[model samples]
Target: MSTVATAFADSSIMLRRNVKHTLRNPTTMFNAVLFPIVIMLMFVKVFGGAFSVGEHYIDYATPGLLVMAVSYGLGATATAVNDDMTKGIINRFKTMDVSRGAMLTGHVVVTTVRCLVACAAIVGVAFAMGFDPEASALDWLGVLGLFVLLAVGASWLTVAMGLAAKTTESAGLATVPLIMLPFLSSAFVPADTMGAGVKQFAEYQPFTPIIETLRGLLAGHVSQGDAIAAVAWCVGFAVLGYVWALSTFKKRA
Candidate 1:
């Protein structure tokens, strides 16, 4: 077979295996989907009016919750990688004739599927809670594209964490920063509403631009600057994560 075909076949097998594993353990979806929806509802009901950054508090939260769902999916990737490592699956794969990129491709594709499902659930819950989309279908498509890019980039970072983690708990715990980033960014309220120091940080943070980009896309507003920044950050992180993970993999092998 050609290299491309071989890689595709290997990645397909890996993706199928990962999906089966995820289906067998529905806890992954529970945490990635249910937890985010519940948290979004709780925050909207309790603190929505108190922090009136927008007319529809739930609408303001929908994008952030979606991003959180994508972020949460990274934890599953990390856990799966660690579990495979512990079980010597990585060693077995190394002995195969598969392309090196196939392993990462499989995990990334599986995580992307998980993120999409979680995102759909979040959107359904948001709609049920009366959060309507003000954007056009094309804009929504752009938002989904951005999210999928973010998911792919974040999966790489989780892979690096998985390779570096000493234990399964560590692999899971390593995603805390991803979980906390939205809270620290402009997800909940405007950066101006934060204290001066926090405002400064939030203004420049990666998640702030990402959230702003998604918000603008959902709101049908032009947000070229935020969109550019978000994509740049995503690409930068993906490259860094890929380099680091490959180096680590080589050394450990």
Candidate 2:
């Protein structure tokens, strides 16, 4: 087989291996999907009255909550990659004829799948709780495209973090930013309502554009400018994460 085909075969094997690990560990999904739902509940039940965005509170907040849940999945991705690295599984592969990049590729692919699953779960729960987005089919398609870009960028960044960590604990810490970023962004509230410093940061940060784009798409108010910014952020993260992850994997292996 050609090198391309061999790499695909190797990546498929690695994908299955990592996916089984994720399935065996249900806590991974719990960690990835629960907090966001809890927060969603709190916002809807306790503070839902105080928030308004020209629509129902759930309608407005669902997009941001979904994005946060998906982003948080990277924490699990990072930890899993770290486990493989520190547990000598990667070194074992290095000693064999396995494709060098396949391990990371598999982790990334599975992470994306998990994130999508989390998104689906959160959306379903939102629907059950009367969180109707009222979006059209094409709009849902657009949101899905946004998620693909987001998963690509975030999973690769997680891979890079996994490669950089010296231990699994530190790997967890390394991705704390991923978990915390949504709070500081327009994920829960409008950036313009924030304090000046925070507003500026929230307006410019990576998650802001992504969340805003998701919001706009779902709400049927998408502006071309925000869409452009979101795509740019996705591309930037994807390129940067890919280069960092590939280089680090090569160095570590």
lDDT per residue for candidate 2 within 1-253, as digits (tens), equals 9999999999999999988988898788687767678888898779878866667888878878877887777778888899888899999997888998898899989988888887888888888888767568898999999988888888888889988899999998898988888889888778878997999999998888888888888887788888999899888878888999889888877
Candidate 2 Cα errors over 4 Å, as ranges:
none
- Report the error of model 1 at residue 118, Å: 0.7
Write one digit per residue (lDDT tens) for candidate 1, span 126-151.
Answer: 89889977899999889988899888
- Can you tell me which runs of candidate 1 are displaced by over 4 Å? none
Alpha-carbon shift of residue 213 in model 2 (angstroms): 0.8
Q: What is the alpha-carbon RMSD of candidate 2 to the true structure? A: 1.3
State the displacement of the C-alpha of residue 26, model 1, in Å, after optimal TM-score superposition: 2.4
Instruction: Work out how many backbone clashes candidate 2 has.
Output: 0
User: How many collisions per candidate?
Assistant: 0, 0
Quality of model 1 by C-alpha lDDT: 0.85
Query: What is the TM-score of candidate 1?
Result: 0.95
Residue 178 alpha-carbon offset, candidate 2, angstroms: 1.3
